[model samples]
Target: MNIDVPRILIAATQSGAGKTTIVSGLLAALRARGLKVCGYKVGPDYIDPGYHRLAGGEPVYNLDTWLTDEQTLLNLFARTSQGADVAVVEGVMGLYDGGAGGVSSSAQIARLLGLPVALVLDAKSMGESAAAVALGFRDYDRRTDLRGVILNRLGSDSHRELVSSALERIGIPVLGALHRDEMLAVRERQMGLLPAEENGDRETVSRMRAAVERGLDLEVLLEAARSAPRLSVPSLPAPARRAARLRVGVARDPAFSFYYPESLSALEERGAELVFFSPLRDSAVPEVDRLVFGGGFPEVFAGELAANLGMKASIRAAAASGVLILAECGGFMYLTKTLRTLEGSVFEMVGLIEAHSAMNARLQTVGYVEAEALKDTVLCPAGTVLQGHEFRFSTVEPEAPERFPWAFQITRKRTGATSLGGCAAPGLLASYLHLNLLGNPACADWFLGIASDASDV
Candidate 1:
């Protein structure tokens, strides 16, 4: 909290309440005002944070209590917000929506960071009832500081007057009222919005920026942000773990881009050299002893990846050669035998594992998780405890029913559906779960142990 950045949490009453749309515009507006802006997402979402970075020029950091401990979350917020004028944290689903225990929601983060909240209420149809939602959220949590309210998708001047009068009757101040606009919404596919990296057309991105600028009132939002006080908190000490003198290959491309910058930095801090490569473009894995694949839109690039026969073969060879590998959601899909897109088009993938994944109508895995390594692999020592989240919309179709590999046992940390688990092949570990190793420092020791053994050179 020695950091001098003034921060505010952009939260809402529930999901689909237009929080992302409103927060993105606020970020773009602040950047336009010549202020150094940093954005943070309150949960483990890969897509929404991408748009935040596109507007603010900084990779969005995830703050979640279920996946990471309170201390690590605080330090991540403090350390990442260093040298920033202000920090804007966009909340997940709803203000209080979290996993099974409902303990790690956005409101928890607000109290933990001692930051004020500006609730974005969707007022397309509701009138005075919007005030009830705002008040309920404000009074529901005594510890949370509900500073003000922003009415999004408002109908007209008369509509705003009705909603404003109701909020005034309560104690929450009305900051701004935004009218609904179709053009202001960014396009989303199965997973969510495409990461800014895949959006090739700068004009389209700029047009989205312009839409955001014109929809929400920037001045009012910035004023609300400025009203928030600075936080004075302690920093988290670096995790105590062993180091390994090995190079780990990380996937970086249009297909696999949901990697947290901190995860890679943690590996380096623990003495592992990270070599980034693109599975979509590169014909082979880097000359490293291990591999780490994060999440992204592998479904969109299915055909291209299928055509990249050389890359697929090279990955298979690497696994066969006993290279330690860790693949997350999208990375996990890429290592399968094949991947089917939403349009029924299939692409060939590395056959290191026996499964074939296909896009489904519903997201298969989503939310925080606690995974224990069933076997000693690249990610952990045998029986090591691991914490992470799983997010995917695809299901695997194996050639043989019993051939499905389950090398790890996964338990959902919060309230969400259960997942199958991880797969293993002598030094390789892959799963749809995305884990931030800083919380559970043991992962560093586990990964290093595998990397050290594989780095026999």
Candidate 2:
């Protein structure tokens, strides 16, 4: 099927070039014009999409060619983009930064979807040299549709003109020029921008929209988006038609908010109804057949989580009764016997797994990984292989390391290094690796199947 989804990818010359702020502002500005806009992030990032949701007033989706194949990615893009006047995608890092061959880079997505790119160039120090940078990016990959440039952090009107003229001489259209304003900045911490849920303030989004309205050329940007050719999206397989026979409790709060929209939708499509409950604030776990905990900032709220002894006991009782559980990253940290912060503070966790998690001074792992199931588990059968990504700043130490039932033999895609990770038991699997179920739909089916059997028992 061929679909014409007017889309534009807001890419940057490099990281720290303010593309997130620009994209968030653009989404708000477009929505203010009474246009139904959809927002997306280019890779496996969960933080930036929170800001996108704040600005766009819609749930943001991810588009990653690494986590899933091109066909799946295109289908997801096409499906999520339905009923929208335009789609705005925020790129990851620099345009060309990704895996070994730029597999999941913003440039790759632009070329794959034939989307026009409006490069955000930081114009803090140089004037005409900005053109050289834009020229380099434009010619670096001829396949990339570098349609225009947006000058960010301009010092003054004169500065904007100085840079805009230079870009014009090289035949690059100047789409927007935003003056440097500290009020438009979002706070950051170890991971990246603080999740918008934590910083729940509509005022910040208002400032971003006002700034974009005053600085950007919305008409030109829309024109560039409309210039994209109609995409040939492959037909997706029909979802299983079944009534909800299983209840899956999903942990969701300020501390546990890193879930993929499609991953949750996949479970619902396979006869499971998701019931989201807060692990930090709720005194009792929701009555459900299974539980799911995705990655988030559990360590930051370790003290609060530990203080909620009732919630902890509730989860423990659920696990003891053979309630199947799946956790990743922060969710993995929460299921351990204890969590130790970087400041040497220790707090109690669920103790479902006989392991202690400790925050490290630096990141322990950050890359894509391939996992081969070591044994039969709720998610998959033995020998089942899946792709996932891991980004964490903590390490897990098992009480009896030699006796731990490691779930998968993980191979780091970038380094080819092998490691034994994840804890697997009769009805629980917890790991630091994050999986997108869209790429592993069979796993979702297997999970729901196991949950159904457990509910029957």
Best by lDDT: 2
Model 2, 1-457: lDDT tens per residue?
6658899999998989999999998999899889999999988999999989989989899888878889988888888888899999999899998876887999999888888999999999988999999999999998999988899999999999999899899999999989999998889878878888887678888888888899889999999999999978879987663464888999999889999898898888787889999999999899998999988988899999999999999999998888889999999999999999998999999999999999998978888889998988778887988898998889999999899989999999898999998988778888988989887877887787733343222
In angstroms, how far off is 62's CA in candidate 1?
Answer: 0.8
For model 2, what is the error of residue 13's alpha carbon versus the real structure, in angstroms, after optimal superposition?
1.2
Model 1 segments more than 4 A misplaced: 1-3, 199-232, 239-245, 401-405, 414-419, 450-457
Best by TM-score: 2
lDDT computed for candidate 2: 0.89
Q: After superposition, how far is residue 68 of candidate 2 from its true place, in Å?
A: 1.5
Q: What tens digits encode model 1's per-residue C-alpha lDDT throughout 30-89?
A: 787788889998887777787788778776788888668887887888888888778999
Candidate 1 global CA lDDT score: 0.77
Which 10-residue span in candidate 1 carries the lowest summed lDDT? 448-457
